[model samples]
Target: MIFQPTYLDLLLSGDLKKRAADFQRRLKACDLCPRDCGVNRVEGEIGFCGVGNQVWVNSYGLHFGEEDPLRGWQGSGTIFFSGCNLSCLYCQNAEISQKVSGSEISVEVLANVMLELENRGAHNINLVSPTHVIAQIIKAIYIAAQRGLKLPIVYNTGGYDSIHTLKMLDGIIDIYMPDMKYSEPEISGRLSGVPDYPSVNQIAVKEMFRQVGNLVMSTQGIAERGLLVRHLVLPGGLAGSKTVLEFIAKEISRNTYLNIMDQYRPAYLAGRHSEINRRITSDEYQVVVKEALRLGLNRLDKC
Candidate 1:
């Protein structure tokens, strides 16, 4: 293997271990995510995320469908954590995110899973929907980094993050893949059921961008560090792609990598709603993509 410093080296620096410990301590009282449920997860209390004391992972494997930079020759070491803080009406991974369909795994086992991914030639460790299991993930990262795990770590989140908790990961996560889900609060609340989501996600995404700027890649084009913003274009512009792009252009850097996705399909509870019970129109997606380009967002993902 190449002589590379473990990803944790950057993250666990400057008393980050103490921050992790303190964050873990708070989870017992459990105000981990933005919800501030305070359910005492250490005692097996399930909060808004439906995750209990232990970490429940749905699957861990090499995923090729991610952005090109993330999926080099070898795929991303994708660990799909079960349960999500927000249950969007049109959620694609409803089975795992909503139902929390996975067996509980110990931190040691989770660390081994990271090792197995590295052994299988994965380019990085990608944590999906990791809000509830941040503590366990951090602990496992500590364990894996000590045992020769040196791959970059990716924090793939839904933009619903706790500022305090994210501060603890300042140097630990190399790649930040956050979704700019909505730009309007009412739309976000109606679809994703998160009140004041625009302000919430904006603050959280700003923090992510502050920690890691634009997407940086290895000489081989694999992601090493930086930020990649994903915005899924929903039907009727309900996902608020236009406003999200504008915010990216105005608030964030214009050079930031923006992924305007067209892969929206009515799933989960979306079918139960009138405006969102169908797939997004091709015109709708084209308009948003065009808007992104007109706004000088060049780093778009076609796949």
Candidate 2:
């Protein structure tokens, strides 16, 4: 059976075009993410993300560093967006994410990039840090789908998305890959500059799971569709992994594809904060891994 991405239905019904226009219109008083900066991006007013109406791409290519199902034999088609909504102190890709460093490209060009990745035989269209530019992506998808973009769309985000935006993206995005950064407001506030991260992240995760439940894969171990959650273990257990695991087990689902990442390192402005200014210990990583196991999350990603 040939897999047809959901965007095909939306594109055929003309809903994709309408959604693109509606979302682009939202940039006039932009409320794309949870921050609700409300800056007129179309008219060049900047907000928390530091990006305007135009879509910016730092880089786009086939990335092999992703999880098993996503990477597969052919790498995941990754489009790394420039700006980010959350202000994480220890951002690994601060050069692009923090500074919003990227070339301004039109929707047509972005659409072309998707087609190019497809031509190169990418498994999925992985949009990393896509919380801000969903409107542009939708517009590009609208264009690309008509030209035969059949790969599943991956919404890779920092987990600070709004419920309204998620509702709009319900059918467009096939795989929802978001980070569950923290479960404590104080810790989140100190580390990520978003005090409501824990609250906002949980709501966004629920919406993601609602749209696409547990991950479904092909016989070749390629991810077809679903929700894949990523939790980065911060130094000294600051991420509140227990509460996060508990929430996933109790609220989301036991069958959820959990990726408990241990690749936290001091980068960008992390040196200023002594607490998280170093790499996490081996014991720290295992503690969260053990908690996830104890919570009955059996489908943990072997990352």
Candidate 1 clashes: the total is 2
Per-residue C-alpha lDDT of model 2 across residues 1-303, encoded as one tens digit per residue:
677788899988888889999999999999999899999999999999999988889999999999999999999999999999989999999998998787999999999999999999999999999999999999999999999899999999999999999999978999999999999999999988999999999999999999988899998989989999999999988999999999999999999999999899999999999999999999999989988898899899883
**Which window of 10 residues has the lowest lDDT sum in candidate 2?**
1-10
Looking at model 1, the pairs that clash are: 11-171, 11-172
Residues 1-303 of candidate 1 have per-residue lDDT tens digits of: 242533555445635456567767988888778899988888888898988878998898999999898889899999999999997988998999998787789989999999999999999999999878898888888778778788888999999888888888887888889898998888888788887778978888888889888887777888887889989988887887878998998898888887888888888888889898888888998999899889998888873
Go through the candidates in order and give each one's C-alpha lDDT. Answer: 0.85, 0.93
lDDT of the structure predicted as candidate 2: 0.93
Worst 10 contiguous positions by lDDT, candidate 1:
1-10
Model 1 off-target regions past 4 Å? Answer: 1-7, 10-16
Q: Model 1, residue 253: displacement in angstroms?
A: 1.1
Superposed model 2: Cα runs more than 4 Å off: none
TM-score, per-candidate, Cα-based: 0.95, 0.99
